[model samples]
Target: MSNNRQPDWDPRSPAVFDDQIAAYDRMRGRCPVARSDYLHWSVFRHADVLRVLEDHGTFSNVVSRHPSVPNGMDPPEHTAYRALIEPYFAPERVRAFQPVCRGVAADLVGQLPAGGGVELMGGFARDFALRIQCAFMGWPAELHEPLRQWTHRNQEATLSGDRAATAAVALEFDGFVRGLLDARRKAGNAAPDDVTTRLLRERIGDRPLRDEEIVSIVRNWTVGELGTIAASVGILAHYLAAHPDLQRRIREDPSLLPAAIDEILRIHAPLIANRRMTTRAVEIGGRRLEAGARISLIWASANRDEAVFGDPDEFRLDRDSAHNLLYGAGIHVCPGAELARLELRVVMEELLARTRAFALMPDKPPVRATYPAGGFTSLALWVERCS
Candidate 1:
């Protein structure tokens, strides 16, 4: 609930959107907790972000008027839905998904040009996300392009801060999920026993789950899959392309990849920030605020905080990973983190194994993606196929 008080900074300004990580870095040092009209209040420091993460009771996740399924719930209700979805990402499930995940990665990697200029973001990284996510959900290949367009529209609406448009886009997505659910229901016992089908059968209480509830659950999964996975791939690919020697070294010893990917993403986060709302009056970073205060925990800044990492850009495989806020933390920590990590590791392995080398094109620099998306909008890399 920000008011007519002088705002600290503009989050949607050209300066901030140009390079969100650097802008967040500047904010972390200047004002650890600053108020802005766009984001209300943004928590920039690692310590403050950690505090908010640990104290979920004080900083509620019910920040939006629109329901965000489990992500927008607090405690008991969140606890139930959270527990329901946790098994889908269990270690056994992830292990089961690896071969399928690897197949998707390899297919996408094979589509990369041989020793030529290619825009990795457009049809490659983005397509991989769409295809892999659909495959995971037991969705049809036909949904890939539609989902891509849907994701683009969703990001645009969010960036514009258009609640109506965002909700409209959300409804459109719900339609997509509902259509699939209808097909499953019509098929009944013949329906494919996939994640979506299982969700349809799940019960939240004594009553069976409703369509809206299932839609919300699928929405969360799809958004996490389509947006962050695409961004993560582009970021990892760009990082490797920009640092050929490290790329060569990782290629030489593939075992370094899992830790290396985590460290690199810690330095340049694929997901920028997430929202929270205060339930009661609280003082954070020397700033006092009342109830229903809007807060944004900037993961991009917290992970790169100099106090935590000392040298934010110093890539290392040996650093204690407990501090990395890449998948968030606490009760709200992303359920999909393990899947994300496995997906990233598999994709990078395929990308590196398939190419002899990948370097940033001399004349073509990558265009940085804006607010709702991290990584590049377009990344041109000269990729040499393995001989």
Candidate 2:
């Protein structure tokens, strides 16, 4: 594989880091299928991305050498693990957790400042995500701070592209999960009957899942839940604050929250992109890619493609949901979509129900999160609580 193609874009550039959504939008128009030094090949258009996703044989999910549970697997192997993981997010399971999720949301919303500016990301969004995830996994409150810090470190290591740093952070996370597993094992039958403990008992092919497998599965779930859920919260709140009319409509009609939440997330994606590797030479978006080429599905851009959606930023409740790739499509669609939906819907319901209105703080604007992260890193909003 001789390399002679000039880079189409620099994914690590300061401009991309400043506003990833806008940058991706530009890329989608300029070069739907792009090549870069860091990301290798990036897919931007909705149709092109859907093509890659549908044809998993050509564009494989086994992009990483490291194990990623089901996310990094393909075919029969992916199918088995997906079956094992799907039950955890079954409709019944997600419905059962609604109360717990609502309780966490209500508590966080109630803690918002009475009449002044509030940094939604720190003061409310992050805490809500942390609490709900810990509760779902039967983890102790003590793990909240550590997990939050771990998420930050993981993102930093990923952005730096320092393999050693990324590996070190991953090991730190594994250590945390391993300790929990050991404690649960020691407790025997007395162990809490939760997702984590249940995973320890899950069997694959007539034998119990190995410790490493369990860690990987749990790590995948934790990362998705913590990062996307938190980013989604901030994005939702910011959208509502910026669009007071839609906010008021949702506040008046709580039934619209679910659809509205999905639409808002589509406009500004939480999880930026997913990786894939081309198994064979293929042509996509008029660009020829050789075998073993790395692919990055830019969800942030694909969901907002003008070809699919007339105006990427337009807020429409009646739009078709199937076209939205917020949870993705095809074999590798998000397993926890129902759980994520329930979490987002519950939190927004509580917030809107509790407050008359919340508006963006003019003096303190939000700082958009860098690449590998979506939504605001810090969002300041002025709240007007219900009297």
Candidate 3:
């Protein structure tokens, strides 16, 4: 996997995840808009990422005619679906789920080794986030394990760059989500407050949304929420543990945890790239992009661009310009972003409030994902609780 990275960089090194500052620093000007047969033309500069996202007409989100629910659709259709689902992830709704998210975090963290030694990723990161998503979306708890397994499998298949496998997994996941939607409809009227109930009853494009569309939105969301949120917890814990002073400051004042989490996500976005298709001939970085060219907006690289963010490699919790492209830009930005933020904040508060410190084992290094999914694979930590 490391060898697949640009010849100049080595992400395979265990130390890189622990210390990505140097690698990202070296990548800025060298290959800002690199083209690869596997991932296509990856835009690393902040300006390029923003331009690709902002110019929907030139670089359409509807890439390869993929069935990505509304994510693949441009304005109008995209706008309609966004209207239907955006409210569900609004600030107030995120706030409403805080208690549930907090409870889930506290329960999981409490079950960890109080004195020390816990695999932060699998121990609590993956399971807890999956459970929380289940409760929030009115999905059954029994499906958590199955859903987690499916998320990992689908990610691997998609990253393999295999069209057949990606399609197979997509169909399987869509079926699972569709079953849930069907059950909701048969049971008649949502219990008044569930997201599925609302989605089932909503209308899009002059008519009610199809069951498959609802399934696609819910499936994409759950898969993303579970993996990214879980991986983020590991990243947050690792960074905090490595910097005791920052940990101490955050422990002393919980208010800083949210800002700290945002900074952490901005600095280490779990996602790698999102694809866009060029509509016509265009120029980028003095290169001509012909019509129908597939481009990848590399958020991981763009988030670290020095032009928009001074001293971009440094992880400053109080960075004045943290408008990182981690959550993407423009209209197609993640609708569940606020929900993700709230979940991270609550989890960080719980972990920090309970554990005094966490340390990576001297000899054992953390695991990381391959090209497409870029984040921690395993985060083993030694927990120290406050007396």
Candidate with maximal lDDT: 2
Model 2 weakest 10-residue run by lDDT: 1-10
Report model 2's TM-score to 2 decimal places: 0.97
lDDT of 2 by residue, 1-387 (tens): 123298889988999988899999999999888889888889999999999999999999998888999999999899999999999999999999999998999888888877778889988988888899999999999999999899889888987889999999999999999999999999999999988999999999899999999999988888878888999999999999999999988887899998999999999999899999999999888888889989999999999999999999999999899999999999999988989999999999999998878999888989998777899899999998775
lDDT of 1 by residue, 171-270 (tens): 8999999999999999999999999999998998898899999998899998878888888999999999889899989999999999999999999888
Deviation (Å) of 364 in candidate 3: 1.3
Q: Which regions of candidate 1 deviate over 4 angstroms?
A: 1-4
Instruction: Give the Cα-based TM-score of candidate 1 against the true structure.
Output: 0.97
Q: lDDT tens string, model 3, 185-281? A: 6787534458777888888767888877887788778877877888788888888877888888888999988778878777777776789999998
For all predicted structures, in order, the TM-scores are 0.97, 0.97, 0.91
lDDT of 1: 0.89
Candidate 1 clash figure, as a count: 0
RMSD of 1: 1.7
RMSD of 3: 3.8
lDDT score of residue 356 within candidate 2? 79
